[model samples]
Target: MSAAIRNYALVTGAYWGFTLTDGALRMLVLLHFHALGYSAFEIALLFILYEVAGIVTNLVGGWLAQARGLRFTLFAGLALQIASLTALSLTNPDWLPALSVAYVMGLQAASGVAKDLTKMSSKSAIKVLVPANADGALFRWVALLTGSKNALKGVGFFMGGALLSWLGFSGALLAMAAGLALTLIAVAISLGSAMAGPAGGIKPKFRDVFSRDRKINVLSAARLFLFGSRDIWFVVGLPVFLASELGWSHIEVGSYMALWVIGYGFIQAIAPKMLRAKTREPDGRTAQIWIAVLIAVSAAIAAAITHDIAPELAVLGGLLVFGIVFAINSSLHSYLILAYAEGDKVAMNVGFYYMSNAIGRLTGTVLSGVAYLYGGLVGCLVTSIAFLTLAWVISAALPSRSGASTQS
Candidate 1:
């Protein structure tokens, strides 16, 4: 394989491993702590630091990666994750509730920082490695990377439950740490003397990561609400509903969510062909249209629950449609960010975009518990609709075409 392809494989593989553990860690914490009688809001609080840290991590990690090289950021992220896992594994179940919460939140913050660092490194590499003039290749490659990463994350969700069952919480965490450690070692050895992506050589000022480009700024706004809409319902409401009302076991809830995410990822992988990006790339107009459709789907789900139809059937069926449609939206946004990114500062640009993403997740994560506690799934879906509406409004401002201020 060519050096570019080989390095891309290594970066993708490393992030795949990181994402697996990241997904599993989320499941393990949610399920284990909930089983320990943590309230939904309290459970949500545990993750607050995780999302909060991502906000800072993505913004700064991008600059660090650009200044120090992608390899530096990637390795630092991997090490931090391993440390976070190992530290969390030592949680003492007998501790006071407040103490336990504090401990886990601190570790989760570490994991969050690790996650953004690794993500910014891997994703920024794509624009650097893929030729800008290669018609349609960038979109296809981005879809594959993003889709496959989500698919593995779904598997990790299932694995989390399985591991928790087979080996208690501490055991499951340790196992994941061990596996990730091996992954880190492999990447470190294989990538010796090779740069994962071009580094700026000079440190970017903090303010420099903030993009002023209209297309990028507009797209970032749209992306914020787009992800917020998904997580507002997806994070706490869905699995909690499946478990509490549906009376499903932890494993069953995990498995169903795994299935949903797997299917979603599948659609994303094929989105390039499905959306006909080869014939014409998706633009701001496309994003607006798709978000509108998603709003309708979300509203239908909310209405079905309100009217007390076969609520489960309606939710399940409607969600399948939502996943397929959302995947297209997500895949489009993923490609657009890279397309709009200024070439010279790809890492910084990607970082700033994801900072907005982290903010949205923070909003959704908080609202997931609040909305679900008050109105259950219906409340969550309604809130999601509101977020999507905002996204559609914001996307209306996106440039209708695909030429960006690119750098080589």
Candidate 2:
């Protein structure tokens, strides 16, 4: 294999390991806390720090990765996760509610930092590894990486639930920590020193973390609403709905969610083929068209729920359709950010893009609880539609095929 391919493989492998643990951590915390009698809002609060930390981490991590090296950031991320996992294993059952919440939140913040640093490093490395002239290679590669990561994350969710049943919370966390520690050691030894080094030896300034390109800025704004649309329902609303209204068990809930995400990732991996992206690169117009369709789908789902027309079937079927389209949208966004970034500033631009992504998640997470509390699933779906519409409006500013180019 070529050196570029080798580095890409190493970076992707490391990211997979991290994503698995990250998914499991989320499941473990949500389920464990819920079982301990925490309210839905309180459970949501547990993750607030995680999303908030991502905002700062992405902005700062972009600069750090550019100055230090992708390898440095990647290693730091893994180390921090390991530390967070170990700390979490020390949680005492006898602690006060406030104390426990504070402890877990602090640890989650560290994991958030770890997640974004590793993500920014791995994604930016692709810009360096893939040749600029390779037709459609960037899209395919990014989709594959993103898709596989999500698939593995879904598996991790299942694993988290199973481990909780078998080993309880502390044991499950310790096991993940041990596994990740081994993965970290392997990555440190295997990856080359220059895997994600600074481009052209130029020292990137902190201000460069924000993008100046109009396309990137518009796309980033669209991305913010696009993701918020998904999480507004996906995060708190859907899961709580499943448990409370549908009477689904924890295993059942986890399994269904895992299946959805796995299928979503599969679609993402094959999006290039499905969308015929090879013939012509997807652009702003492509995003707008897909999102418009998504808005219709979201509206239909919401309407079905409101009218009580086979609500269960509407939700399950609608989400399947939603996942497919959303996967394509996400894959396109991933490709576009990399496409728009200058080679010398790939890390910084990616970081900025993901900062917007984190903000979207934060917004949706907060609203998920509030919306659900007020109007249940119908409320959540309405909120999702609103966000999708905003995303569609923002996407109108994106350059069409004539102006956009995927070639970096």
Candidate 3:
């Protein structure tokens, strides 16, 4: 392989590991806290802490990525993840566990921003080599990487759950710690050999590039908001609801989640074709239209989930519906962000895009908590339906492929 290829592959592998470890933690989260006797409100509080920390990190992380380059930022983030996970594993006491976990949550949030910076920066560096016709290819790559990573993390969760059943929380924590340590080691080595040099700083001059182009900026902002809402519901609200309401075990839940990701990965593979089939002009509006349709459908499906449904059937049905929604919407969202963004300010554009999603996440968690408290499943369903409606309307407002103007 060429040196560039080798380097890129190593970085990709590092990200894959990073994702796997993160997924493992996510899969175990509700169960872990529940084991520690945390209530739904407490869970929301922890999630809020996590998002609050992310808000702070997003700003600093963007600046760090601008100054230190994507690779350095990613590495630093990985380091923080390592320490944070280790700390989290050690602190599981009833009284102090939540507070300790919150601190770790903050670190995890910081790592999230750093990781986003790294992924986008790496993609930018390699964009020149990729085919121009590949509008959603980068998003496809991310989905593939993340999906596979989560699949592996599912394995980790399965093992952890079994171990927790047999050997208790300590054993589960040990296994998680081991996996994260290995991932950290792998990323450290990859960064050493693949991305040791100084990274290029962000270009502030291009920050206003979008502002100068009002049409694209407006479209981009709208798209970002729509996507932000989509992510918050999918990532924060859905998982918690299933776990709490359906009494699903982590292993069972992970299996369903794995299926969701499988469906998503399959859609990502065909995202290019989906876009092409939707439009002859190739302006990528095809992707957006499909995304809108899927988001609306997913919201509808999520709203219909209730305790009267069989656990197995509910999981499968919900997974299938939400899976389709997530796959199409996520792919299109990535394509839109990249399309609207200037090459010079790719990092910031990507960061801002994520920050928007983070904002939505913050809102979703709070709302979901309130919804669960009052109306139970109905509240969760309503929130999702509202967001999806907003997304669909915004997408309908966007200009067609042929008539679309330059997005900054």
C-alpha local distance difference test of each model: 0.88, 0.88, 0.55
In model 1, which regions exceed 4 Å deviation? Answer: 34-42, 196-200, 243-250, 404-408
lDDT (Cα, tens digit) per residue for candidate 2, span 1-408: 887788789889989999999999999999999889888667767888999999999999988888888888989999999999999999887888889999999999999999999899889888888866677888899999999988899999988888989999999999999999998898788775755467778898888888898888998899999999999999888988889888899778878999999999988889999888778888889999999989999999989988889888998899999999999999989988988887778888899999999999999988988999999988998999899999999999887862324344
- The superposed Cα distance between candidate 1 and the true structure at residue 282, in angstroms, equals 1.8
What is the clash count for each candidate, in the order shown?
1, 0, 0
Candidate maximizing TM-score: 2
TM-score of each: 0.93, 0.95, 0.75
Ordered list by TM-score, greatest first: 2, 1, 3
Evaluate model 3: give its TM-score. 0.75
Q: What is the lDDT of residue 396 in candidate 3?
A: 58
Encode model 1's per-residue lDDT on 290-310: one tens digit a residue. Answer: 999999999998888899989
The lowest-lDDT stretch of 10 consecutive residues in candidate 1 is: 399-408
Residue-level lDDT of model 3, residues 187-228, one tens digit each, is 666556443332343345434322344434444555545545
Q: In candidate 2, residue 187 scores what lDDT?
A: 79
Best by lDDT: 2
